[model samples]
Target: MLPVMAETLSQLVADSFEIAWDYLEATGELGNPDIAANHLLDTIEAMIRCGERRRLLLSNNAITAYQRFRAEQPLSLAS
Candidate 1:
């Protein structure tokens, strides 16, 4: 039972991460795809572990968290 639940949760987190990553990529607001990917995965995983099961909600919140993190960093001169 526990293994099944873990697998489901893993799938949920992966789906949420994809949704958030795609949205950010589409917006073209990300300065670094690698950094954004890490942030989205971490945020989504944490949210899932805390009992957030709604896919869209997790994606949206992860996007928002990444945006906030980007905002705090120094402006990058790279393309």
Candidate 2:
């Protein structure tokens, strides 16, 4: 049971990251070197660790986090 639950949670995180990453890529907001992608995944995982389970909510929060991060570190984007 614990393993199953862990797997589901992992899936949720992956899905959320994918959703946010795809949106950023589509909007040309994602940068190179995978920094943006890594940030998105980190944000999503953190949210999950905080008990967030909904896929859309996780993705949305991650996207917002990424935007905020970018604002604070513009150099994260590609040249």
Q: Top model by TM-score, which number?
A: 1
> Each model's number of backbone clashes?
0, 0
Q: TM-score per candidate, in order?
A: 0.82, 0.80
Candidate 1: tens digits of C-alpha lDDT, residues 2-24:
54544488788889988988888
lDDT of 1 at 68: 85
Indicate the worst ten consecutive residues by lDDT in candidate 1. Answer: 1-10
Residue 10 in candidate 1 has what lDDT?
77
**Model 2 alpha-carbon drift over 4 Å, by segment:** 1-7, 76-79
For model 2, how does the per-residue alpha-carbon lDDT over 1-79 read when each residue is reduced to its tens digit? Answer: 4545444877888888889988988988787637887888888888888888889999998888888878777473542
Model 1 residue runs over 4 Å out of place are 1-7, 77-79
Give the clashing pairs for model 2: none
For candidate 2, give the lDDT. 0.81
